[model samples]
Target: MADSQRTSEPTNFVHQDEIWKAHVKVEKDLAKVWPNKWGFLTETYKEYERESLKLKEEARMKLPHHLAARPPTPPEKNIHVSRSPSVPQTTQAFIGWRSAHSHLQLEKYGTVHHGRRSFLKELGWPLDACS
Candidate 1:
């Protein structure tokens, strides 16, 4: 079944983090919209609160001892994102840090592939791979 297949997919850690971050965002939005005729608490908000707490508890237990001892910190701001000035401002395209790093690798290594061995092999500039 489609449902079963969807559930079988492994949950990504980043996706989980995003879900937790969304819960906090929802709470903030609720607070800001409270007491306004147009802004009312919805059933979705209640569901988010319940789910977030359950996920948090599970995560805490799974955390390493040192991390568990310290209070959890808020999600980090996305500072690693790179902006491409060559593209037109009106167009929407996000060039991440990985893309920029890949560009640097290409320039330095000349068509070097990704991975540990390939990276180090490229560093042997004057000598080619022997045997």
Candidate 2:
């Protein structure tokens, strides 16, 4: 896909602009790693990717157009997630724009009820649904 076209496309409805934003975030994060061997997000990052793929799959099958603009279909309740080294899982934490629940873990301490929201807000997630 052309760079411009790719930028214009939505990964899905619920997550439209993140694919590119994440790349930029990583590039900036990597610059701070200072020659570290494991600079990239490892298990959590991989899990994020896998989860993103799953969402994409579901979108293609259940809601293609919705995927392009699908708001989170939360399970009618707030959920708290614990972090894991394995595949990333999602949390119902609605912190802010910096968060991507598609495949992320909870805070290490789990102190915050909505870690995703805080993390995302720090990352610049919009304040809209992030209460």
Candidate 3:
């Protein structure tokens, strides 16, 4: 009766048992090593942070003259006047140019559906719905 019941079970049941056993073994192995690995990674990351901050401080100290000599520039009086009118003109021209260029490209290369239809034809696939 047990033999008959085992034989009645799907082949995948046996495969699933093997897969589950392998998964359990892997989990057990990871559990054994995980704490040591986690400790090593944490220590290494902390060391890296300390070294990086030390190097940044050294670089900053070496550049004291460069940092002090460059005074911050005062804002220009005509900055707002210069930006207000030219910005809109420049933006409008750019938009117009981009629109015309994309239209030209669409006419030259066709759309994504056309490309897919050509690819399917190359693969000798049926295009009943594609048309």
How well does each candidate superpose onto the true structure, as a TM-score? 0.23, 0.19, 0.36
Q: Sort by TM-score, best first: what order?
A: 3, 1, 2
Root-mean-square deviation of candidate 1: 23.6
Question: lDDT of all the models against the reference?
Answer: 0.67, 0.66, 0.71
Q: What is the lDDT of residue 82 in candidate 2?
A: 52
- Model 3: weakest 10-residue lDDT segment is 78-87
What would the per-residue lDDT of candidate 2 be over residues 1-131, giving only the tens digit for each residue?
A: 58988877655854547777888999998878854766455767889999999998976778556446667779746766556443434553434323455355345456666545566677887767565
Q: Write the per-residue lDDT of candidate 1 for residues 1-131, one digit (tens) a residue.
A: 89999998887999899999999999999978785744446666888899999999999889988765666565565334344336434434444433555643336456657664654456865444553
* 58: Cα error in model 2, Å: 0.3
Across 23-125, the per-residue lDDT of candidate 3 in tens digits comes to 9999999999998878788888999999999999988778867565676566774333221223234665766453354433335566466444466778898
What's model 2's overall lDDT? Answer: 0.66
Q: Using lDDT, give the best candidate's number.
A: 3
- Model 3 error, position 56 (Å): 0.9
CA shift of 119, model 1, Å: 99
> What shift in Å separates residue 130 of candidate 1 from its native position after superposition?
99
Q: Per the 3 Å backbone cut-off, how many clashing residue pairs does candidate 3 have?
A: 0
How do these models rank on lDDT, best leading? 3, 1, 2
Off by over 4 Å in 2: 1-40, 64-131
